[model samples]
Target chain A: MKILVCVKRVPDPETVIKLTPEGASIVTDNVKWVINPFDEIAIEEALRIKEKAAGTEVVLLSIGQKTAQEQLRTGLAMGADRAILVLTDQVVEPLAVARVIEKLVGTEKPELILMGKQAIDDDSNCAGQMVAELLGWPQATFASKVVLGGDQKGAQVTREVDGGLETLAIPLPAVVTADLRLNEPRYASLPGIMKARKKELKEIPLAELGVDVAPRTRIVKLETPPKRTGGRKVGSVQELVQVLHDEAKVI
Target chain B: MIEWSEQHELIRQTFRRFVEAEIKPNLRELEHGDTPPYAILRKLMATFGIDQVARARFERQIAREKEGEAGPGERAAGPEAADSAAMQLIPVIELCRYCPGMVTALGVSVGLTAAAIMSRGTLRQKERWALPLLTLETIGAWAITEPGSGSDAFGGMKSTARRDGDGGYVLNGSKTFITNGPYADTIVFICKLDEGNEPRERKVLTFVLDKDLPGLTRSRPMLKMGLHSSPTGELFLEDVRVGRERLLGETEDVPARAGAKQTFSQERAGVPAMALGIVSQCLELSVDYARTRVQFGRPIGEFQLIQLKLARMEVARMNLQNLIFRQIEMAGAGKRMTLAEASAAKLYAAQTAMDVALEAVQLFGGNGYMAEFQVEQLCRDAKVLQIYAGTDEIQVSQIARSLLRG
Candidate 1:
C-alpha cells in the first residue's frame, strides 16, 4: 500500500500575527513556521495506515518555497518513507495547487491521497475538493476515523458532519482529508529526527510539473479583527437577565 | 557570537512542545503531591528515544573499553557531536524553564551515574550497572557528599571502605543530599580507603552497591526548600560487604577522587543551561507582568524603576544565552572547559539567574512572593544553583586560585 500525504507549512498558531507595513499581508520576518496542525493529523493517519499494512510506503508531499523542506523533514521524522517538495515561491491558488498535485498523482501513483481538509493559513477548504474533482476520484473529507478494510481493497471512514458522524466505505485510490478529531500525532523522537536527516527528500521545480501554476484569487487587504470590549458585571440575576434580554437580545 | 541553526531550533521547539504537553499538566503532582519524577522522566526518555541513543552509545563505549581504548572525551567535538550534545541539553533547558527538579533528578541518574561507570568502571562493571542506568531502566545515585563533607569533600570525609578478612571491602558511611537517593536501585558509593594512611590523604575508592543489601539503609526524602520534585535523601551504610567485582575499576588505583572532580566539572558546565532556562522564564513573566500591571493610571512598565528592572533582566538573559552559545561553540571545536573555567561559568550564570529571579519577585510585588506565581518557584529553584555542585563562594575561590597560580 502507498499513501501520499499533502502537508503545508504555516506560521505557528501561537504566534501573535502582525500585518505588514502595507497592511496587505502578514509580516513574515520573525514568524516561526510549523507544520500545519491539521496536516500533522494527516501525517499521523498515514503513519497509522502504514503500521497496519505491511510494506506500506508513506510519502509526504508539499508545495512551497525551500523553507517548506523543514516541514517535509518533520514529516519524514514522523515516519514517512520519503518526501517530495514542489518547489515554488509563487502564490499558487487552490486550483493551481490541485493541478500540481494532479501532476504528482500521475507520477507517484499512490493508492490513497491523505491531507488536511484545509491549510490553516488560507482556510480555503478548496484544494482537496478541487483535486478530487480534477482527478475524478472519490474523497472522504473531514475524516475523524479511518479503518482500512481487511481485504486491503477499501477503507471504512467515519467523517465529522453537522451534529453527527457520516460513515462511508471508500475504495482504494481515494482522497481522505483529516479532521481535528483524527488521531493525535506523536512527537518526533530525537533518534527519528536524526534518521530523518538521512532520508531522501526529492525536490521538483513547479515548472517541471507541467502545470499552469496560475493563481485564480488574490487578497485585497489584510486587517485585524475588531478588539473585543471588556464585559460588564451585573449585580443581580434580574439585572443580568434584563441585559441579556434587552441590550444583548440573547436571553 | 553563535546562534542556533534551523535544525537546532527545530529540536528545541520539539522538546518545548513535549514539555508543555507532558510536564505542564502533572506539575502540581510532581511539586507537592508526593509523586516522584522518575516515572515521568523515564517516559520522556522513551518518548524521545533517548534511551536508544544512550544504549547505542554505551554499547560502542563498551566495545572500545574491551579493546583497551580510552573512552570518548568529556567534551563534544565536531559538528555532529556538538549537535548531539545540544540536542541532549535542549530538554534540560526546556524542562528547567518549568521544573528544574526534573532535570536535576534526570541528570543524576543518567548523566552523573552512567558517566561514572562508563568513564572509570571496567567493561564488566559497565555491563552490570551502567547500561541500565543510561537507559533509565534503573535509577542510580552517585554518593560523594557526606554529612560532614559539603565543601571539603576529601579533607572532611568520614566514610570509609575497609578491606575485610575475606579480601572484600566493608563499607561504612552516610551520604546526604544525594539525588535519586530515596529510590535509587543502584548506588555508586564513594569513600576513603582505610589502608592505615593519614585521614586527609587516604585513597578514595568507589563501590557499586544495590539498594536492599544487608546493612544498607536509605532514608525517606527530606523536606527541601526547592527541587522537591527530585527526592533528596540520605544513605547510611553500616559495614555493607561487597566483593572485589563490585568495585568500580576492581582496583583502588582508579581514584574515585579524580572522577568526582571530572563529574563536578561536567555538572558545573551544565549549570548555564539550567540558569538560562530559569532566567529566561523569569524575564518573560516579568515583561508580561510589567506591560499589564496597572498602577497610577498607567501600566507599571511606564515607571522608570520597573523599566530598569526589565532592562537588567534582559541583559542577564542575553549574557546567559551568549554564555551557553559559547559553550556549544567550544564543544563543536572539540574543546573542554578547564575546571576553573567551568566554575566561572557556573558562578556568573548562577548569580545572574538569582538576581533576575529576585527582581522578578519584586516586580510582581505581593503576587510574586506568593506560591501562586511561577516566579516565586523559580526564585527558590534558582537559589540552589548558587549552592549545589559548588557554592558561589566555592566557584569564586576556584576561579581565583587558577588566576593566582597562573
Candidate 2:
C-alpha cells in the first residue's frame, strides 16, 4: 500500500509577522518556516498507517518554491519514505495545486491520498476537495479518526462536523483531509534528521507538470488587525454585567 | 563567519518545540518538587536519538580499539566534528535557558563519567560500563571533588585504594557535591593509590564502581542555593573491594592528571554555551520587561539606566555567542582548546552570565525578587557557573599561569 501526503510550508505561527511597505504581502526576511500544523497531522496519519500495514510506502508531496524542500525534508525526517516536490517560485492557487496533485496521482498511483483540511497560512480549505473532485475519488474531509479495513482495501473515517462526528467508509484510492484531533505529530528525531538527507526527495519543475500554474484570485490589500484594548477589571459580577451590557451591548 | 546555518536553525526550532512540549510543563515539578531530571533527560535522549548516536559512536570507537588502533581523541575531528559540536551544544544552550541544572546533570553523566571511561578505559571496560553511560541507559557520577578538596583536588585528597593480597584493591573515599550521585547507576570513583606514601605523592587512580556495590553508600540530595533540578549528593565508600577489572584502563600508569585536565577543558569549553543560554534568556526577559514596564509616565525602556543594563546584556550575549562560534570553528579545524584557553572563555562566560542575570533582576525591580519572575531563578542558577568546572578564581589563575609559563 502507498499513502501520499500533501504538505505546505508556512511561516511559524509564533513569529511576529510584518507586512510589506505597500501591505501587499508579509515581509519574508527573518521569518522561520515550518510544515503547516494541519499538514503535520496529515503526515502523522500517513506514517501511522504505514506503521500498521506492511510494505506501505509514505510519500510526501508539496507544491511551492525550492525552499519548500525544507518542509518536505522535515516530513521525510518524520518517517515518510520519500518525497516529491513540485517546484515553482510562483504562488500556485488552490485549483492549480489540485490539478498538479491530480496529475501526480495518475503516475504515482498511491492507494490513499491524505492532506490537511486547510493550510494555516491561507486557510483556503478547498484544495483537498478540489483534488478529490478532479480525480473523481471519494474523499473524507476533516478526518478526526481513520481506521483501515481488514483487507486494507478501504478505510472508516470519522469527520469532525459542526457539533458531532460523522463516520464514512471510503473505498481504496481515496482522499482524506486531516483535522486537528487526528493525532499529535511526532518531532523528527535526530537520527531521522540525519537519515532524511539520504532519503529520496525528487523535485519536478512546475512547468513540466503541465498544469495551469496561474493564480485564480488576487489580494488587493493586506492589513494588520487592530490592536485589542486592555480589559478593565470590574468590582463585582453585577458591575461586570452592567459594563458589558452598556459598552459591548451583547449581554 | 561561523553563524548558524539554515539547517542548524531548523534543528534548533525542532528542539525548542520539544523543550516547550516536554520540559517546560514539568519544570516546576523538576525544579521545586522532588522530581529527579533523569526521566526527562532520558526522554530528551530518546526524542533526539542522542542515545542511538552515542551507541553508534561508542561501537565504532570500541571496534577501532579492539583492532589495536589508538583510541580516538575526545572527539572525532572530522568534517562533521563542528556540526557534531554544534549539535551537542545546542541542547546545552536550550536546556540552560530554563534549567541549567539539567545540563549539569546531563554533562556530568555523559560528558564526564562516560567520557572518562571512553578516553582511558580498556576495550572490555568500555563495553561493560561506558556504553550504558554514553547512552544514558545507566546514570553515571564522576566522583572527584571531596568536601575538603575543592581547590586542591589532588593534594588534599584523602580517598585511597590499597593493594589487597588477592590482586584486587580496597577503595575508601567520600565524594561530596557529586552530580547525579544520589541516583547514579555507575560511578567513576577517582582516588589515590595508597602505597603508604604522602597523599600529595600518591598516584591518582580512577575506578568504575556499580551503585549496588557493598560498603558503598549514597546520600540523599543536598539542598543548594540554586540549580535544584540537578540532584547533588555525597558518596561514601568504606573498604569497598574491587577487582582489577574495575580499574579504568586496568592500570595505575594512566596519566590521571592529564586525563582529568582534558575533561576539564571540555567542561570549561561547554560553559560558554550554557552561559549564552542564561545570559540570552536574561537579556530577552529584560528587554521585554523594559519595553512594557511603565514607570514615571513612560515605559522603563525609555530610561537611560535601564537602557544601559540592556546594552550591557546584549554585549555579553554577543561575546558569549562569538566564543561558542569560535569553539565550533576550532572543532571544525580539528583543534581542541588548551586548558588555559578554555579557562579564559569559561571565566568570561560565567562572569557575564552572573552579571547579566543580576542586571535582569535589577531591571525587574520588586517583581524580579519575587519567585514568579523567571529572572530571580535565573540569577540564582547563574551563580553556579562561576563556581563549578573550577571557580572564577581558579580560571583566572589557570589563564595567568599559561601566560607566565617560561
Candidate 3:
C-alpha cells in the first residue's frame, strides 16, 4: 500500500508574530518555521499505517518555496519513503493547492491520500475535501481514529464531532484529513535527521504539473487582535454585581 | 560564528521536544526524589536508535583493533568521526539545559566507564563488560578518585592492588565522589600496584570489578551540594579477590596513568557541552524573567543592571557554543585536543557557566533564591561544573604547567 501525506511549512505557533510595516502580512525575517501541527498528525498516521503493513511506502508532498525543503526533510526524517516538493513562491489558495495535489495524485497514483484537516496559519480546512472532490474519491475529514479493515479493502475513520465521534467506513483510494486527536507524532531521532538528507526529495514547479495555479481569493488586510487590557478589581460583592449588570451587562 | 547545519538544527529540535515530553514532567522527582536517571536515559537511547548506532560503532572498532590498525587511544581518522561526535554531544547539551545531573550520570556510565574498558581492556573484557555499559543495559562506574586523592590522584593515592599468591590480586580501596557507584553493575577500579615500590612511585593498575564480589561494599548515595539527579556514592573494596582476567590489558605494562589522563581530557572536553546547556538555559530564563517581572512599575528588564547580567550571559553562551563548535571541527578532522587545551576549555566553560548561573539567580532576585524557581536549581547545578572533572585550580595548574614546559 502507498500512502501520500501532504504537509505544509508555517511559522511556529509559539512565535510572537509581528505585522509588516504595510500591514499586509507577518514579518518573516528570523521567524522559525515548523511543520503544521495538524500536518504532523497526518504524517504520523501515515507512518503508523506503514508500520502495520509491510512494504507500505509513505511519501510526503508539500507546496511551497525552497525553504519548504526543511519541512520536507523533517517528514523524510520521520520515516517517509521519499518526498515531493511542488515548488512555487506564489501564495496559492486552497483550490489551487488542491488542484496541484490532484495532478500529483494522477502521476503518483497512491492508494491513499492523507493530510491535515487545516493548516494552522490560515485555518482553511478546504484543501483535503476539495482534492477528494476533484479526484471523485471518498473522504473522511476531521479524523481522530483510522483503522484499516481486516482484508485491507477499506478503513474505518472516526471523526471528532461537536460532542461525540462519527465513524464512517471509507473504501480504498480515499482521502483522510487528520484531526487533533488522530495520533501523537514521534520525534525524529539524531540518526534519522542525518540520514534524511540522503533520502530522495524531488522538486517540480507548479507549471510542470499543468495546474491552474492562480489564487481564487485575495487577503484584503491583515491585522493582529486588539490588545488585551488589564482587568479592574471591585470593592465588594454588591459592587461587583452592580459593575457586571451595568457596565458588562451580562447579568 | 557557530552555525548549526539544517540537520543539526533539526536534531536539536527533536531532542528539545523529547526532553520536554519525557524529562520535564519528572523534573522534581529526578532532582529531589530518589528517581534514577538511567531508565530515562535508556529510553532516550532506544528512541534515537543510539544503542544500535553504538553497537555498530563498537563492532567496527573491535574489528579495527583486531587488525592492529587502530589501537587504544587511536581516533578514527575522518571528518565523519567529528560530525558523529558533535551529533552525540547535541543531546548532552540539550539535557543539561534542564537537568545537568542526568548528563553527568550518563557521561560517567557510557562516556567514562565504557570508554575505560574499550580503550584498555582485552577483546573478551570488551565483549563481557564494555558493550553493556555502552548500551546502558548495565550501569558502570569509573572509580578513580579516593578519599585521600583528589588533584594528586596518583601521587596521594592510598588504594592498592597487592599481588596475592598464585597469580591473583587482592584489591583494597575506597573511592568517593564516584558517579553511579551505588548502582554500578560493572566498575573499572583504579588503584596502585603494590610491587614493593615507593609510596609516591607506585604503578597505577586498573581492574574490572563486578558487584557482589567477595568483600566489596557499595555505599548509599551521599548528600551532595548539586547534581542531585546523578547519584554519587562511595565504594569500599576490602581484600577483594580477582583473577588475571579482571586485570585491564592482562598486564601491568600498559600504565593506567596515561589512560586516566586521557579520560580526564575527554571529561574536560565534554564539560563545554554541559556548561553550554547551563548557560543557555540560564540566559533564556533570565531574559524571560526580565521581560515579565515587574519592579518599580516597569519590567525589570528595563533596568541597566539586569540587562548587563543578561548580556554577559549571552556572551558566555556564545563563547561556550563556539568552544564546542571548535571541538566538533577538530573532532571531524580526526584530531583530539591537547590536555592543556582541554583544560583551558573546561576552566573557561566551567567558570563562565557558574558566573552566568549566579547572575541569572541575581536577576531573578529573591525568587531566584527560592527553590520554586528553576533558576535556583540551575545555579546549584552549574557550580558543580567548576568542581568536578578537574577543579578550576587544577585546570589552571594544568594550563600553566603546559605553558611552562613549552
Candidate 4:
C-alpha cells in the first residue's frame, strides 16, 4: 500500500514575523521555515501505517517554490520513501493546490492520502476537503487516531470535535486530515538526514502540470494584533469584582 | 564567509526544539535535585541517532585497522568533516545555553575518555571499551587531575602503576574534581609507571579500568558553587589489580603525553562553542530585560550605559561565533589547531562568557541576584568555563611561552 502525505513549508511558529511596508505580505528575509506542525503529525501517521504494513511506501507531496524541497527533505528524513514537489513561484490558493493534488492522485494512485487539517500560515482548513471533493473520495478531517483494517482496504479515524471525538470508518483511497493530537512527530535521525539526500525527490514545474494556479481570495490588508496591556492588581475580591464589572464589562 | 548553511540552521532549530521540550522543563530537577544527567544524555543520543553514527564511524575505523591500515587519525578531514564539526558543536552551544555542566560531563565521557582509548587502544581494547563510551552505554571519566595536581598534573605525580611481576599491575591513585567520577562505568586512569625510578622521571601510562573492581572507590557527588547539573566527585584506587590487557594499546611504549596533549587541545577548542552558547543566551536575555525593564519613566534600554553593555555582549558573541566557525573550517581543511592557538581561543572565550554573563546579571538589577531569574544561574555557570579545560593562568602562560619561543 502506498500513502501520500501532503506537507507545507510554513514559517517557524517561533519566528518573529514582520510585515512588508504595504501590508500585502510578510517580510520573508531570515525567516526560518519548518514543516507545518499538523502536517508533521500527518507524516508521522503515514509512517506509522507504513511500519505496520509490509511493502508500504510513504510518499511526501508539497506544492511551493523549489525551496520547499527543504520541507520535503525533512519529511523524507522522517522515514518517507520518496517525495514529489510541485514547484511554483506563484502564490497558489487552496483550490489551486487541491487541483494539483487531484492531478497527482490520478497518476500516482496511492491508496490513502494524508494532509494537515490546516496550514498554520493561512489556517484555511479546507484544502483536504477540497481535494477529497475533487477526487470524489472519502475523507476524515481532524483525525486524532487512525487504525487501518487488516485487509488494508479501509481505516477507522477518530476525529477531535468541538466537545469530544467522533470516529468514522473511511474506505480505501480515502483522504484523511490530521489534527494536533494525532501523534507526536519524531525527530529526524542523523542517518535519516544523511539518507534523505539520496532519496528520490522528483520535482515537476507547476506550469507543466497545467493546473490553474490562481488566487481566488485576496488578503486586503494585514494588521498586527493589538498589544495586550498589563493587568492591574486589585486589593480585594470586591475591587476585582468592581473592575471586572465596570472596566472589563464581562461580569 | 563561514555562516551557517540552510541545513545547519534547520538542524539547530530541530535540536533547539528537543532541548526546549525535553531539557528545559527538567532544568530545575537536574540543577538542584539529585537527578543525574545520564538518562537525558542517553535520550539525546538515541533521539538524534548519535550513538548509531558513532558506532558506524567506529566500525569503519576498526575495519580499516583490522585490514592492517593505520587508523587515519580519528576524524578524517573532508567534505563531511565540516558538517561533522558543526554537528558536534551545535549541541555543545545549545546545551550550554541552559546547562553548561551537562556539556562538561558529556565532553569528559565521549570526547576525552573515549577518545583516549580510540586514539591509542589496541583493536581488542577499542572493541571492548571505547565502543560503549562512544555510544554512551557506559559513562566514562578520564582521570588525570589529582588533589595535588591542578596545572602541574604530571609534574606533581602521585598516582602510580606498579608492575606486579606477573604481567599485570597494581594501580593506586586518587583523582579530584573528576567529572562523572561518582557514576562512571568506565575510567581511563592516567598514572606514572613506577619501575623503582625517581617520581620526576617516571613514565606516564594510561590504563582502562571498570567501575566495580576491588579497591576502587568512587566518592559521592560533591557540592559546587555552580554547574551542579554535572556531578563531580573523587575517585580513590588502592591496589586495584588489572591485567596487561587493561593497558591501553596493550603496550607501554606509546607516548601517552602527546595523546593527553591532543586531548587538551580538543577540550580547549570546545570551550569557545560553550562560551558562545552562554554569551548568546545572556545577551538575548539581557536585551529582553533591558527593553521591558523600566527605571525612570523609560525603558532601561534607552540609557546609554545599558546600550554599552549590550553592544559589548554582541561583540563578544560575534567573536566567539567566528572562532567556532574557524574551528569548523579548519576541520574541513584537515588542519588541527596548535595547542597554543586552542589555548588562546579558550582564554578569550572563557573571559568573554564570564564578562557577558556578569553584565547580563547587572542589567537585570536586583532581580539578577535572585535565583528566580536565568541570569543569576548563567552567571554562576560561566565561571567554570575558565577554570576547567585549563585555568586562565595556564592558558596565558601557554600562549606567552609559544610567542617567546617563536
* Chain B TM-score in each of the candidates: 0.97, 0.98, 0.98, 0.98
lDDT at A38, model 3: 96
Tell me how each candidate scores on DockQ against the true complex. 0.66, 0.58, 0.67, 0.55
* Top TM-score prediction, candidate number: 3
Indicate whether candidate 2 or candidate 4 has the larger lDDT. Answer: 4
Candidate with the greatest DockQ versus the true structure: 3
Instruction: Rank the candidate models, highest DockQ first.
Output: 3, 1, 2, 4
Model 3 ranges with Cα > 4 A deviation:
A16-30, A149-153, A162-166, A218-251
Write model 3 residue lDDT over B1-406, tens digit each, in one string. 2687888888888899899889999999999847999899999999988898899888988898889876666776676776798788899999999999999999999999999999889999999999999999999999999998988888889899999987889999899999999999999999998888897888889999999899999999999888899999999989999999999999988868999998999999999999999999998888889999998999999999888998888988889989988988888777889999999999999999889999888888899998878888988999998899999999999999999998
Q: Interface RMSD of the predictions, in order shown?
A: 1.0, 1.3, 1.1, 1.4
| Error of model 4, residue A54, in angstroms | 4.0
Clashes of 2: 0
What is the per-residue lDDT of model 1 for residues B236-274, given as tens digits with 9 covering 90 to 100? Answer: 999899999998899879967789899999999999999
Model 4, chain B only, scores a TM-score of 0.98
Report the poorest 10 consecutive residues by lDDT, candidate 1 chain B. B68-77
CAPRI category for model 1: medium
lDDT of 3 by residue, A1-251 (tens): 89999999999998899999888788999788999999999999999998989889999999999999999999999899899998998998899999998988988999899999999998989999999999999999999999998677899999999999899999989999999988999888767887898999999987888889777777778999999999998899999999999998999
Tell me the whole-model lDDT of each prediction, alpha carbons only.
0.90, 0.90, 0.91, 0.92
Q: What is the lDDT of residue B86 in candidate 1?
A: 83
Report the lDDT tens digits of candidate 2 across residue range A1-251.
99999999999988889999988899999898999999999999999988888899999999889899889988988899999998888888899999999999999999999999999887999999999999999999999999999798999999999989899999988999999999999988877876787899999999997888677789889888898999788899999999889988988
